[model samples]
Structure formats: C-alpha cells, structure tokens
Target: MKKSVFLACLVCFVSVLQAQNFPILGKVVDSTSGQALSKASVFCQNTTFGTITNNEGLFYMNLPNGGYDLVISYTGYEKKLLRISNTQPQKDTLLFVLAPQDNSMAEVAVVASNEVADGWNKYGKFFSDNFIGTTPNAAHCTILNPEALRFFYTKKRNRLRVTAKEDITIINNALGYSIRYQLDSFSYDYNTKISQFTGYPLFEEMDTTEDVKKTWVSNRAKTYLGSRLHFMRSMYDSIITDEGFTVEKMNDDPKSTKGSNIENLYDSSFYFVDSSGVSVGWDGRYRIGYRKVLPDKKFLQEFRLPANASVQVTLLDIADGFVIEQNGYFYEQYDVINSGYWAWKKLAELLPYNYEYE
Candidate 1:
C-alpha cells in the first residue's frame, strides 16, 4: 500500500472506532468570556477518533466501554484532559471552560505581583517578544519526538530510542510498524532562539500491507509532535522580551557546552530568530514553555531554560482542579518550567507570592 493511502485508512479506522457504540456530546466555552471556541480539537488521547468543535464550540465522540482520556485543546488557551468511564446508556453531556493564562500572580489568586498593571505588561512583553515569530527549542527532531511521545500515548510501549539523530527512527513491534521521520539539517538563530526545522514526510514500512499505514503515522505525528511544534511556534511568536533575542552565537560544539546536549539537536552555529531573554537571576522575567506527561503525573522530562532564572509556573489541570488521584491525591502537581517538576523542592528559597520580579 502507498504511504499516503495508508494514512488515510488509518484515520478512517480510528474515526470509525471512536464513533462506535454511544457518543459523548458537549460544548467548549471560554471561562472568562463565556464564548464558544470553534474548530477546537476534542478527541481521545492515543487515538485519532475525535471531532472538532463547531462554530458553537460543540463536539461529540463515541468511546468503547472502558476508561479513556478525553483531551480538549485549543490555541491561545490551556489544554484540558478528562477521563470518562461511562456506562450510562444515554449520551453523556460534557462542558469545558478554558481560562486565560494568568500572566501575573496579581491578576489571579496568587498575589505575587505588587503592581498588577506593571506586572501584566511585563508578562505581556515576555510573551510578545519570545513568541512573535518562531518557537523556542523546536527546530530539532520533529520526527523522533513523535515516537517518544507515542510511547506515552499508546501506553502499550515503554522504551523508545531515536536510532538516528539525523532522522527520527522508531521500532514499534507492538504496533507492527517501524517509522522514520527524516530531516534536512537543523539551523538556529541565537538572537531569536527560533529553530528553523524542515522535514520529509512520515513513512511506515509495516509487516502488513495496509493503505492506512501512512495516514496512521501521519495522524499520530500530527496529533502529538506536530501539535506541539505548532504550539511551540505560537509561544515563540507571542513571547515578548526586554533584551529580545538575535542569532548571535553559532556553534556545532558536539560537546554542547550548555548543560544538556539536547540543544545540540539544532545547528548551534546558524542564526535563527529569538525573543526570550537569558534570565540572569531571581529578578529576571520570562515566559516559559512547559508540558507535563500524564498517567505518572510526575515531572518526567522538560526543555531546559537558562539555569537559576527566577521563574513562575502554572499548572493546567484536567478540569480547573481535578486533583491527581496519585501522590495522595494532591490538589495538583506544581512544576516549574525552569525547575522541571521540582518547583516545590525548594519553594522556601523563592519568594512567596509566586512572582519572580519584585
């Protein structure tokens, strides 16, 4: 089967499965404005079976008779994840209210900022500068990240290795597929911190010759890493900074003089667009990009920021406050972007208000 044809079949198969049996129905609205979010993606994690919100921000999906993760995600707002294990014969009606990201603690219950106006501006500036054009830490390995993320999605696999850094190659025996995300080279602009990434189409050579093979891979890639890439770009374009960034430093330092070699994924020597600043101390400001893997709900991994940068972190939970049942069902897991999930590790060392700036 051809790659393109395979992917299409894969999409249809997942869609059919999601639509089987009974379906859940609901609308998504902005918590702040009470407005509907149209074209929003409402789907089950690990499966392509899902629907997009209409003009009214309404969506529906059919699920098997088991526990499943219902994820609602849209741009410019936080993502929502809900677990539904429904035995009800009637359609389950669900509603979601997405809150605007709190730019400063003064704007929310966490009163860290003394001047709401100034702090909000600082927040806005941070986003506007860093997120205006491209995204941060995004130019490298668009292909391999998908498989690593898929391990989390399918929950069927455990270990994942990117056999080739130049290409994202994965061996998934359970899925009956071997996937490859080949890339052109990686380049970056140190000033902007925007990594320009280019890639070849996703390919899957499977034991079975099915038409949906490619589409399945494509859909999965887009659903996971592709969406992340898009979000990363959005964040970079929206980030604002006082220092602003430019591609000033360029190096292929195989050593990756920085703390981690992950940064080496991109051509260190090439100049790319940038926006965020290097946080010099507990006083510096930044708009950080962060995402937590679910199930474990622990801070498993993170994209690093300048070390010792005074930072503020926000936890976007499955409802506003759906307490994670693990960890003694703590109200929520509080992880910092710069600090990974260890924000509470040394909370006493940072300021109380949750604001980095004085």
Candidate 2:
C-alpha cells in the first residue's frame, strides 16, 4: 500500500471583550449543479457551535467573535473548510460551495492498497492509543464507531494509514463529552515513531448526574492547568507569570539541552499584545515550564526520566510566528510544531476552543 497525505489548520482576534457572541448566517450548494444542499452539516471546528442546512441550504449559528475554521460536510462530497475571522457582526450570508467526492480515485489511491481485512482487531489498539491518546483520561474513552474505520499498511514505507467511512464517535467518560470526529486521515510511521491525524471534531457536553458533573468540572480544571491551552490564554492576557508559566529560549545547537530564562515573555522583541490580539514571532525554539503541575507519570516513564521530574515542560518551534486570540485560539497553526509533554496531550485531553477555565 502506498498512502500519504497532510493538512494544516485555525486563527485569532479580540477587541474590548475577549470574544463577543454574534449571529452568523451561511449557505451550502453543489458546485456542479448550483443546487442547494439540504441537511448539510455546518460547524466551527473544535467548537460546540454547529447547525445543519435547511431545505434551502441555509444555516445559522451564533459564534463568539474570534477566529475559526468553518467546516462544511455532506455525504458523497468533498468537505470544505474556510478560515473565518469573525470580529464583527456579519451582515452578509456566508457561502460554501462543495464539489462531489471522487470515490473511485480515492479508493484507488487509498483503499486499493494492502488493506487489512481484520484491521480493527490487528491495529485497533495501536490506532486508538495514538489517536484518542494514552493519557489517564483516555482510559475511560471509547470509540463508539470503530466499525467505520478502515486500516491499511504499506510494507515498503513501514507506515500504517487509517480512514473512516463516516464520522467516528467517541465518548469521553472522564471529561463528560461526546465527540463526533470527521476523520480526514490518520497516519503513523513505525520508523520515526510519529503519528499524525487530521480532522474536524465537534464536542458536545454529555448529560450526567449532578455528582458526575461536579467531578467533570474538577477534572476539566485539573486538565486545563499548565496546559498549552492555558499557556496560550495567559500569553493573550499578558499574564504568563501570573499563570505560573516560565518561558526560556532553547540553545541554538540541536544537541544542546540548555536554555536561558526569558525574563520578559511579553517583551517587544518576541511578543506584543493589543486590542486585536497577541502577536508572537519568536525566532527560535521555546521551552515552556510549568511547575503548577507535576509531569505525568506516563510521560516520565516514557521518557525514562527520574521520578523526581517536577515541571511539566514543552518545546515549541514557531515557523514565521503566529497570532493568538483571547479564547486561546491561534493561527498559522501548521507553523507551530509541538514536542515533549504537549505532544503527548492528544485528543482525549483536548478541550473545546470555546472552553473557559473560569
């Protein structure tokens, strides 16, 4: 099997209020026939905001003012994604034009490869470990629609690829959320021990008992603290130190592990905050250290580090920099590569973009 693909995605902006909620209208239509596509799924990626198009192909959603990737999907059609920066009330209806999917080409390109008939049984654990994650929260997570998955292995490349026939359902009992994931692609390289997956996931808070809800609240708060999401939000609010995070510039040499303390995270040289948002164009790698929470035991063991490891640290490489909004959303997301602890925090630990710690 010869299979490969890649993707990049999100954005940010803010004003007086971090993000003001406003109504947005949109329509979806077939590009070839110019006909309205009814019942099409329209959503803002990584957020709970979503709606289905009506008979006339119209839909509306009230999204907080910020940057988002508007996702449009319908059966047997090529999915469309639009980067939207909604800072003001939209007066005009947004439009989405999608083309029919080439199932034949996609099949020949991806499916016709050396597919494993018992893929789920063979690679199910591997896939789930990498996709849903291996965090403590992930232990209680279940892939509700495992049957939708199709796995392929390319012997030549020592790579495994997984795709889904439809949205994959995931129930995160630990976080008390149900996730509908539109899986575009998931690939893993055995040689590099690298796994990458791309998709638009819509999160919905699950109904539960009051006791469970309280437990979920506590869990979410613990997960959010010292997280990359927390760091980004602190950066936007110009409260890095207040949030108990420290920034350091990594040594120039790739082999060197030493770094220098970044006394001023909001220094004009690498960062700035304004009414619009925060702009950070850090030239080199940054080491973010958070002592508010200790490193996960699994992370400590996985890295073969001492049990005394205190700080939860992450390494970041920014390509040409990126901008962040008050909601902790960032843009040129592809340019920001995460390593270390942050890389280990996958979907199971992810919170909705609209998540508010307070």
TM-score of each: 0.30, 0.92
Candidate 2 to truth, TM:
0.92
TM-score of 1: 0.30
Q: Give per-residue CA lDDT, model 1, range 204-316, as digits (tens).
A: 33565565555544433322321222222332333322112111121234234222112321232421333221111111122233332121112122344444433323221
Question: Which run of 10 residues does model 2 get worst, by summed lDDT?
Answer: 1-10
How far out, in Å, is residue 162 in model 2?
0.8
- RMSD after Cα superposition, model 1: 22.2
On TM-score, the leading prediction is 2
**RMSD, one per candidate, in order:** 22.2, 10.2
Weakest lDDT window of 10 consecutive positions for candidate 1: 347-356
lDDT of 2 by residue, 1-358 (tens): 1232222111233333335766678889999998999999999888888889999999988777667888999999999998776653456898889999887877678655989999999999999999988899989899998999999999999999999999999999998889999998999999999999899999999998999999999898988999888888888888898889998899988778899998777779878776567899786788999988899999898889999999998999877888898678888888989899989989999998888775
Global CA lDDT computed for model 2? 0.87
